[model samples]
Target: MLVFGPVRVIHCVAMITRVDTYLHSVPLSGAVAEQVGPFTLFRSTITWPYYARPVPGSEATITADDIELVRARCAELEIPLSFEWVVETCPSLGAAAAAAGLSVVEHPLLVLERDDFRPATADARLEILPTEDDVIRQARAAVNLAFGEGGTAVGTAGPAERDANAPAVADGLVATLRDRMLQGVSVAAGAFIDDGIVASGNHQPVDSTTEIVGVGTLPSMRRRGLGAAVTSTLVEHAFDHGVDLVLLSAESPAVAAVYERIGFHQIGHAGAAE
Candidate 1:
């Protein structure tokens, strides 16, 4: 059930962040856990892999040496290092991270309260659907209308666009997204009225926390409440599944405002430590 740990929404951050340069999930076996500074890292594959704290720790402050050790380990593994955390700031630590030439991945970390969440307006006939092979194809067509041809072109892909910079389609990724959907962690809806998949996103489930991810609405469909409806529909389903904490990262206050109307609160802004 642990697809991707510490998943912040891949909204506009997807445009700037490649921290997922690795894949999702760890191997069934325990990932190698090590200590660097005060932070702990759990890793499976060495090169460009996903990692997180092996376990929560009580200590908070870390020394410069601690950061250097963590970096040295990442270098040993030949993998790109990323920050998996939540704190006020990391000025010194960020500088250390940068001196190592670690690729910067900044984001506006977001969270939504389960109890306070609600959709803005119920104008659209929203539907909660599963991920499918054809879903990407449908998403492409719908996004063309919603986000416009420029930014939404990422949807034009259907399996062939996985790692490429072209549109957002990829064959293997589509299959993966489908599996995540069936796992009850992903969803995409076709807008017959809108004429395509006007909305699509995935839920990265960690323990009981579910982060609404990959949430995107077509530009043509903007201001019609489709974004809020699609997101609300997904949150309702997550609640039904017994998830209590729903979080996502948003880049724009406009987008954040939609989630705000639905029962989510602005917990804080999460960006680079520096």
Candidate 2:
């Protein structure tokens, strides 16, 4: 068993700042980060565009007009206008986005300190996959199918669905993942059985902090603890590689509870509007 030290309020606030800064840096790496009013609009140089986020430490209240300006820029670029932010830190942006006719959703944001991780148990074997591994495509397909089904509950989807979709995984996406892994910016992990990858996830590291994203288990594989095990593998990998803080935003409280069982705790909420 692992024991977690009490986090001071001051320390927590400072960690939140680091998380915000790290989040801002990710989009800037692959997109053209432009300042539109009080928000930073991340215009994609590729097929998919990114969202606008409030500039860190900016006190200017986000207005409908500010949202419109970003909307206009997104329109010119032929991309959907969207926004994401830490709700506690950027409290006003959600309402402004909602008032601008975007649907807003709040997700539970959780964090795990190095000392807080507890290894989770599952029947499937968990491993950190190399960029060149052929199973990478299968893992991505499993993730896509898992997220498409959309929930923590077990359903009909399984290995058959995963295999059928594996070949359709975009070559560009696989290439991007490989390039990012080679650059030491991202790491991918999976929980596997003989059939193939049952659960998959990735972590993007920036300095001493990393955020786990896109973790999902095939619907038929749910309730077997694969999601938690995969998350633990990623978190352990991050800590072993010098990351001190691991963060992830869960789709809901129920989803957050899976991470909580492995020692993550809610620190805040992440807001998204589209």
Candidate 1: tens digits of C-alpha lDDT, residues 134-160: 656556444434334333223343222
lDDT agreement with native, every candidate: 0.52, 0.88
Best by lDDT: 2
Which 10 successive residues of model 1 have the least lDDT summed?
Answer: 19-28
Model 2 lDDT per residue over 1-274, tens place: 5544666767777877878888998876568988988999898765356899999877678888999999998889788889999887889888898899999999998999977888897998899988874678898899999999998999888999999999999888888777778888779999989958999999998888899999999999899999999999999999999999999999999999999999999878899999
TM-score of each: 0.64, 0.94
What is candidate 2's CA lDDT for residue 7? 67
User: How many pairs collide in each candidate, listed in order?
Assistant: 18, 0
Choose the strongest candidate by TM-score.
2
